[model samples]
Target: MSNKTFFSLHGGVNVIGGTKLHLTSGTDELIFDFGATYEPGKGRFDQVLTVRPGRETEDSRAAGVIPNLSYLYSPTPSKHVAVFVSHFHLDHVGMLSYLDPSVPVYLSQPSFNLLRQLEVVGEGIGTHRDLRVFPYGEWIDFGRLKVLPLPVEHDIPGATGFYVKTPEGTLAYTGDFRGHGLHPEVTTAFFARLGELGTNILVSEGTRACEAPRPDAYSESEIGTVIESAVRPGKSAFFMIYNRNIDRIATFARAARSLGRELVLTPATHHLFRTLSPEEYRLARPAVFVTQEFRVKGLPPWIAGLDVPRLTVPDIAREPARFLTELPYANLNELVDLRPDGGSCFIHSDGPPLGEFDPAFRNLKQWLRDFDLALVFARSSGHASPEYLKECVNLANPDILYPVHTANMAAMPTPAHGILAVSQLYQKYYIPGRRG
Candidate 1:
């Protein structure tokens, strides 16, 4: 067998999310992340035009939702293949169910636990397979390649970066990390360790590379402060947040408690909190929102089993000053029943329909406008700032830099002494060995 190691980009090049990176040493193959892109209306399929039920894989491939890698999904596959997930984001793990069950999939213990909970709640895609969970800093051998999973700080818990030692060289893949989130120290330590290991190649994410710095960009702590200040003293407040963003949830919970108001959560968020962190759920003491749908169709078994305080729209509407509730975009119709006061605050905290690009975002704005509610943005991004991204790249100081998961590769900073290779989709590049 040839001693050469090859690298290829199957997805997540020039786009913000759908990242699928493939590396190979002879017959041994490793796929870092097998997720789809997050662009809402740009894709071939939408909410109304859905993919076929049984032909999900086939439909996705035809629609360019996923890469056409037969070896990874076909029945009679070739080569030795394995998948290592960096986090539980849909853009990173959306296509995992489509992969052949014979291949082994690895994830961090926390990610595995959270994924199982998501599956149980019917929010997860694909069926369970050969999922192997590993602790932080443990090395897993894959014949000619060995991988070390390192913890990093992203918006969601259990986020990780990978340090792979291939036959040709060593490379570090930074999987969607930020230095301003709840755990900046973890990100700092991750880069410090990469510098110590002396990587030959660095595959980094530059999600914010092209965007100019904004004055509204606040740290996670700052977001909490902003939330506290934005809500009025004698008015009910509704905030939208990503369900998986436990830190943000904690921030809201803290803010609510400080104001002597009860933090109310959607049933889905309550399920996630109770399942993932029971202690947190207890400390937060949040009340679950009993939606109209839940009342009409009845609560599911998972929700019925939860022993927590519940609140209805009537309860919130009666004493608006006493509660702060979570409002998902899908539950916008509830606003009609709510009939919130004219000056009520609606804080958007990094939830779905994130930007104007998404159709749902416009709909969210329309709903708030119809209710005459004040829309306040209290969001901190999950990706690192451009300056921080450059600092991270310089710290690692790899021999070669491959910038991925960004809209503009030109905007990303290159290592002072390294070559910046603009990678193309499906293009193969030979990996070089470390210098003596």
Candidate 2:
């Protein structure tokens, strides 16, 4: 009845410190996500803003995993071959470069596509990281380890949860998910099948466990309508979302079409959409192409009018504000700078609140206030809410509950299930032993 293990690295509490389950079994050292650490209170941007490797604050990763991996021998001489990234966020894949390149890294098609764009754009230090792309739902074998990529709904396209079958049992890892009631329930049906698998040890995210369930969550249609309504006859829109957010990109495309305007995409985002989308979606390429879409020359005749506003990140970073004045704008009258009557969707698809807070989203809000912009936040996070977290626990009905990806790990509500806290050094957790 003892749940105590000879060795296991339950990551520290934070959105970035992904749970790294290292069993004592032979090279069964599979890392679910090699994310980074985040410490609040510093003026440093990287620390609070993104889960970047060696970001501002103390980089436990940069110093190299000490006591955490101290249990297992350092991964120097012996390459720990199995590394799976549920998604492409910096936190999920930040440590990829740090790991021995010899170890093969696996990511879902969409995620790998997005990561590739980010790397090419010089987004972060991830470019140096090595990775191998696996189609969703495929089973990949690494020595004795068998891994399956389970698609999950997140803000990002190609987001996935993983199902791992070890000698111990079948465990499901929900990388990050939100049951947004959208897309004709395909995603929900997909995840519901996970329950049918009778997965054991359902390790899940507790990021939104502190928040109440948001009813049905934002659906693609509702979001599109809101975004469409916001963008009127003239005004241009600017959204601050990570490049990995491809599903959101699809939503934007549909929304723009609804508004009779072409959806202009950043080259970075187009890079992701081209690779992650279905083979059919590759019929036509966007103007500002990133990676080559399936050997094709045109998009579906249905979307000929649907503009693929493809502008590069370099085009923007050189002069972010200039993106407004140039491409699809510029010569357009000031009245067209934005829709008349003030309709614009100013979305902040980031957390820890990008930019500076206080003056509202740092000074970005301040800069837009004069524009007389109509802000509509039509966005949904990928993390499950507290109610959904409880619902997930009910679905799998696990022997214990271990919530990662949040500072308030202790706050997660796991009534009947045992609270398995992956305590800090010397920290004690009395999780009920798995029933033999």
Highest lDDT model number: 1
In model 2, the worst 10-residue window by lDDT is 323-332
Q: Write the per-residue lDDT of candidate 2 for residues 1-436, one digit (tens) a residue.
A: 2323222444534543545544323554566776654434532343345445544223443343322443222345353446677776666666555554456677787666666556654664333345688887788876555778877777775677877665556666778777653442444544466567755555667776676555535654566666555554444555545546666666655554455543444454555566566442353344452212311454333233446644433433343322221121111222233332344435554433443423335445544455555544656666666666666666655555566676676767663544454434223322222431
TM-score of 2: 0.70
TM-score of each: 0.96, 0.70
Task: State the weakest 10-residue window (summed lDDT) of model 1.
Answer: 427-436
Candidate 1 per-residue C-alpha lDDT over 1-436 given as tens digits, one digit per residue, 9 for 90 to 100: 7667877888889888889889888889899998878887677888899999988888888876777777778766787999999999888998888888877888998898888788777877566467889889989999899999999999888999999998777988999999998779899889889888988888888999877879889999799789999899888799999988877888888898888899999887878887787777778889889989988887778888767788888888899999999989888899888889899999999999899978888889999999989999999999999889888888888888888889899898978878787868887777763321
Clashing pairs in 2: 230-343, 235-338, 235-339, 264-309, 265-309, 284-298, 284-299, 356-362
CA displacement after TM-score superposition, residue 372 of candidate 1 (Å): 1.0
Per-candidate Cα lDDT values, in order, are 0.86, 0.53
> Runs in model 1 with CA error above 4 Å?
1-3, 433-436
Instruction: Please give the lDDT score at residue 394 for candidate 2.
Output: 67
